[model samples]
Target: MTDTLLPESDAGNTSDAVHEDRLWCDNGWTARVIKNEDDDGWAVEMIKDGEAEPALVGPWTMGRDKKNPKPLDIGAFNTLVKTASEVLRRHEQQLHAQLHKRLTVESGDGSVEVTLDIVPDEDDPYALLTAFDALGEQLAQVKVAPNFKLSRAGAASWVENGFRRPG
Candidate 1:
């Protein structure tokens, strides 16, 4: 019932050989086992290529003698890569949500949609607020503070005041 994604030669090496605690460039990812600072257990970090930081870090299974970390194999490496990829994807989605927000307001003629997009730059952080009519026509666009809050009341006020920057 065991399934393996790597070639037979690679799989054989992982199972038969006694590998070191760290591996680099194995199956498009790298894994490192480090002593956990918070506890007596060991931790494993999985880092993908071209990434500055490890995408996933978690507890490592102990060896049969219960001292060193269990030798990493193709199965474990594949699983770690899958988990780390998911973590990075979720982090990106969360970051995107934090940078963009939208609100709809009822106007005299129709509904107006307001979108706030934050540009996070270490040197100069700023945001852009844009308004679109019901037909998706751009009504107004202005630069605002990065921490600017958008709401139905704010959108309505902006439209009522001739699309001028809200004070």
Candidate 2:
């Protein structure tokens, strides 16, 4: 894509500075101009690399600096896009790690399967634990606290209770 250059003002350096001709930086995010197929003015889109999609999108005002905005440009838009993408990538990774966890332990009777499922919450992390029979039948399910470490004694006890304990 062709990059548009913004006219320099009293803002700062032009080399590393993000050109405000087309976009601006707010809170370390890059905002750009996109067609607002629905309305007038323009639709501002916040892009963060690695994120599934844009972090934010809304109507934006132009030349609103001091009195109004100047314009949008390439350098400024690129910077904001990179920052927003990083933020999104981190959030996505965190969710993935919390939602899926699997562990397997061998026992005297058979094998104990331990899985930790992270439930998203605004308060604290929550998880679920399930015990399965050797045949993969669901035996029991319990609500487990976040970061709960599986204990060997518990697995051993479950096996002992189900079958003969080794002497």
Candidate 3:
């Protein structure tokens, strides 16, 4: 497939560097200002290298002529890269939180730490329910459905039930 590259501006420097009027490629990312298809205004998209889709897209400021988009400068490109990188970082953090969990509950024996670590397999998604004694000795571990709702009452009940696989 033929790739359509934006015209290089006079600011173009080294082979790996591209500082153009409406396009920039640097720091493993590319920022491009394009006419918004949903509206008459323009939009800016920040895409990481080798990614088919942009990581971030937002409205672009208008130029002095009002009809044209403002040039993509070094400062703007840096800000876009920061914002897009932050977006990806936050997304990864959220996914991690969803896959791992820990909770502490008071059982008749003592305080037990419970954990649920989900394995997001394409065909066999499941979670491991584990219990540990206050001294850090693993009490039991069982494979449960990924959607199992771990709660204080559920954990206490499981501990009280002798740590058999939660049915």
- Best by the TM-score measure: 3
Poorly placed runs, candidate 3 (over 4 Å) = 1-15
State in Å the error of residue 157, model 1. 1.0
Candidate 3: deviation at residue 158, Å?
1.4
Query: In order, what lDDT does every prediction score?
Result: 0.81, 0.59, 0.87
Say what the RMSD of model 1 is.
Answer: 5.1
What is the descending lDDT order? 3, 1, 2
**Once model 3 is optimally superposed onto the true structure by TM-score, how far is the C-alpha of residue 50 displaced, in angstroms?**
3.3
Candidate 1, clashing residue pairs?
A: none
Candidate 1 accuracy as TM-score: 0.82
Residue 86 lDDT in model 2? 76
lDDT of 1 by residue, 45-155 (tens): 988768889999999988898888887766677688789889989999999999999999888889989999999999999999999998999999999999999888887
Off by over 4 Å in 2: 1-83, 120-126, 132-137, 151-167
Q: Is candidate 2 or candidate 3 better by TM-score?
A: 3
Predictions ranked by TM-score, top down? Answer: 3, 1, 2
Query: What lDDT tens digits, residue by residue, belong to model 3 across residues 1-167?
Result: 11334335523533576678888887678898999998889999999999999989999999999999998876687789899999989989999999999999998888999999999999999999999999999999999999998998999999999998888
Clashing pairs in 3: none
